[model samples]
Target: SAWLGALAYGIMKLFGPITGLFVMRFNNRAALMLGCFLCSVSTLVSSFIVSMEVLYVTYSVMYGIGASLVINCVMVLANSYFDKHLGFATGLVCSGSSIGALVLAPLSHFIIQTFGWRMAFRFFSATFVCVGFLNCCVKPIKRKRKGDYEQDKNNTIENEMSFEAKVSKRPSLFRNRAFILWVIGTAFGMFGYLVPFVHLVSYGVTNGIPVSKCTYFVMVLSGATTIGRLVSGRIVQKGYLNSLHFIQLCMIVIGVLFMILPTITSFAGLLPFIAFLGLVDGCYVVLLPMVTCSLVDYNDAILAWGMLAGTCSLSVTIGPPAAGALFDIYGNYNIAFHAAGAPVICGALILFFIPW
Candidate 1:
């Protein structure tokens, strides 16, 4: 199950670049409708599946691709709507995932226990259709024309020409020093990013905490994550720190937390660490697209984000399993947690080499 989950995540992330290209070729509304359609159909089909192999097609590939499209489109739309408070906007928007986990996990669990997995999936499919309808309410922000008609016409022409030039030089994202550094650094950071999420509960249970009580750890983490997203976005929006520097700081903090994670065994002792980790993790996610936008022209920001997501897919895919494997070898999670911290810190330091 763990390996299958990881595979699904990898497939989702691996399609990031394709999702970006799809959005580029079509309007946001069209991309979003396609995503919704795929998600709805995939979930509906998954509800009827009797074989695990078939699940890989319906749940992993189809659902993953749909999710990638939806996520990438949301990021692009968030970037489009706000310039000054991009961090805040993104944080607020991205917090939905944490909120959803906190709210839906228990609901889904209840439904599965009471009804069945199939019914739960059917409910999900129906909810997605509702989401698709809600998305229809989103309209592109129209810029109000101002000044003389001739001035507006000339400005429009210049803007179109500039956009064309940027599109023609799409390969420049690779040649960009900052972009390259950002992608590499982020990829390394991702190596340990999912470790805690996947293992923290099990670690607690294995180290004397009751399984029932340990579940609250996830709730605490999710709640803290929501606050972290909002706070981090506001901080960046206020110009208190550079987005790139802020992300580096968050990565370093998360690495340090991971290193400290294994030393504490008590529930009380672990609470603060879990909360802090959620906070910093939220900050890191909220700042990712903001930093990417800062690194490239607005026209190319989506592509850069796509490339980063695709490049980081490998590390994200292997991170949790690698941690699990280490635990298996050592018969303890101490070394596993420590090992996870190293790559993240190294990645944080690597980002410093990027020229300001």
Candidate 2:
């Protein structure tokens, strides 16, 4: 699963930029539906795969292609859908992933116990197909013409007729200081971000905690995340709370909690820390897209979100293995936790200097 995720993400780097640019120029609705169709078809194919190679091809390659398209498209759509409550809207959209994890974790075990893993894939295929078809109901928002661009959304009118002319005429995203720093800060913070969750059970076991207790810890973390996603939405609605400041605060809290992990002795003692970690971790997914939209024009959605996801994919690829290596070398999780937490804190500090 780990290697497949890495392969899928690495391949995404190639396809994501092209699809993202296409999404920016053309119809977001169509591009999004196409991605959903691809994802649904890949899921269906996964149901029939008997070999590891086939699984990798379907789940990794096809699914990555589908997801890359869908993510960029949705970032554009969500930016347009709720202009006044964009942060809340983004949070709700991202919460869908966390909600899926929350439900599917237990549901998968139940399904396997009742109908086996093979049947679980069949069920997943059916569910995804339904979701894809349902996504077609999303209404298309027409893009402003070059003539109307000046009056709409502060965008200037550009008369470039040729593809090369248009390509040469587009604004330089790399020159934007805020955008560049935000991406760098996110890339750093995202490194080792998910490793704690991946290793929590093993950490518990190493400390002589029972298996059942460790499972409960996982449940608590998931519950905390669900609540955190919702709460962040509400927090964003408050005019006094700056979105970037809130994100930085959450990161600092998460880093501090991770640093203090060694001090927890009992399940009750760990409960608060796990919940705090979830609450802080929730900010990244909920706030990132909305913040990105605020930084750039709505038309820039494809490139912005695509770059973010691609950067996030790179972070995910590098984070866990680095943490594992630290553990392997030290024969302890202290170094790993410290290493992970440091980047998060540093990222938060970097955000303090950023205007957004």
Candidate 3:
């Protein structure tokens, strides 16, 4: 499952630049609607796939295209609507994933137990129909015409875009020192960040924990993630710290957490630690784009976002397989986890060099 998820993300990187360009050039709401529909229809179609390779083609490739579109569109739209409170808005919106995890994780698990995995997929398919409908509510801010001096919401958007347009003309993102460092640092930072979530349940089960208890570890993580995102968003919006601080701190924290995961043998001992991991992960995801936006011109933020997406996609693709191969060799998650964590530590150290 982890490898397939990574593969799907890797496939999306093929479309990442296109998705970013589309969101930047066209109406993001329209792009999001199209993406939502693609996601829904593809998921509905996936219910009948029998072969694993076919599932990869349909579920991974098709769904990943839609997901890449939706991901970039959402980020662009979030910045458009709430530039003044970007951190808060992005965090709140992104928390939808955590909310889904909190609700759907247990629900899907229950449905799979009661009915089957197919039914669980069908159940999610129905919810996505509504997801497509609600996505229509997003309204992309437009470029304002001259003499539009009325004190209105659209005027606020125009004011923000006008400032961004000025900033965008100053320099190219490719030449920005901050952007280059952030991309390189984050690519390496991801090396260890996902190990626990990918292997947590199986690790717990191997250590004599009940299957249900192990599953709830993910639930606990989701709940903590919601809280972390809310808090981090608020903090960023308030100008408490720059996004780099959060990313660097999370890389260091998550690296340490990965090293400790293999040492934990009891369920009780893992909860506080996993909760911290979730919190760090929540901040990391929310801050990743926020940091990119900070590093580059706002007018070209979509391109920066695209680059970051590709970096992340490549890292996740290689990281899990690397960890898995190490596990195959060592016959345990310990050495694999330690190896995974080393790059994150290195990434954290690299972040200190960012000019921002």
Candidates' lDDT values, in order?
Answer: 0.84, 0.74, 0.78
Off by over 4 Å in 1: 141-171
lDDT of 1 by residue, 1-356 (tens): 44546676787788888877776655667777778888899899999999888888888889888888888778757887776777788999989989999999899999999999999999999998998998887775533323445567755765566545545745768899988998999999899888878998899999999998899899989999999999999999898998888999998888888898888999999888888888888898888888887887665677778788899999999889888999899999998888888899999899998888
Index of the highest-lDDT prediction: 1
Pairs with steric clashes in candidate 3 = none
lDDT of 2 by residue, 1-356 (tens): 67776777655654656676777566676777777777778777877788888889998899888877776666556666676676677777776777787788889888989998778867776776777777778876655533664565433334335555565777877677888788788778888576787788878877788987888777778777877777787788766678888787778887777778867757777778888788767775677776776676656667777776676677777887888888899887888888888888888788766665
Q: Report RMSD (Å) for each prediction in the order shown.
A: 3.1, 3.1, 4.7
Better of 1 and 2 by lDDT: 1
| Of candidates 3 and 2, the better by lDDT | 3
RMSD of 3: 4.7
**Candidate 3 global CA lDDT score:** 0.78
In Å, residue 343's CA in model 2 sits off its true spot by 0.9
Candidate 2 off by > 4 Å: 9-16, 143-167
Leading candidate by TM-score: 1
Worst 10 residues of 3 by lDDT: 142-151
Quote each prediction's TM-score.
0.92, 0.88, 0.88
TM-score of 3: 0.88
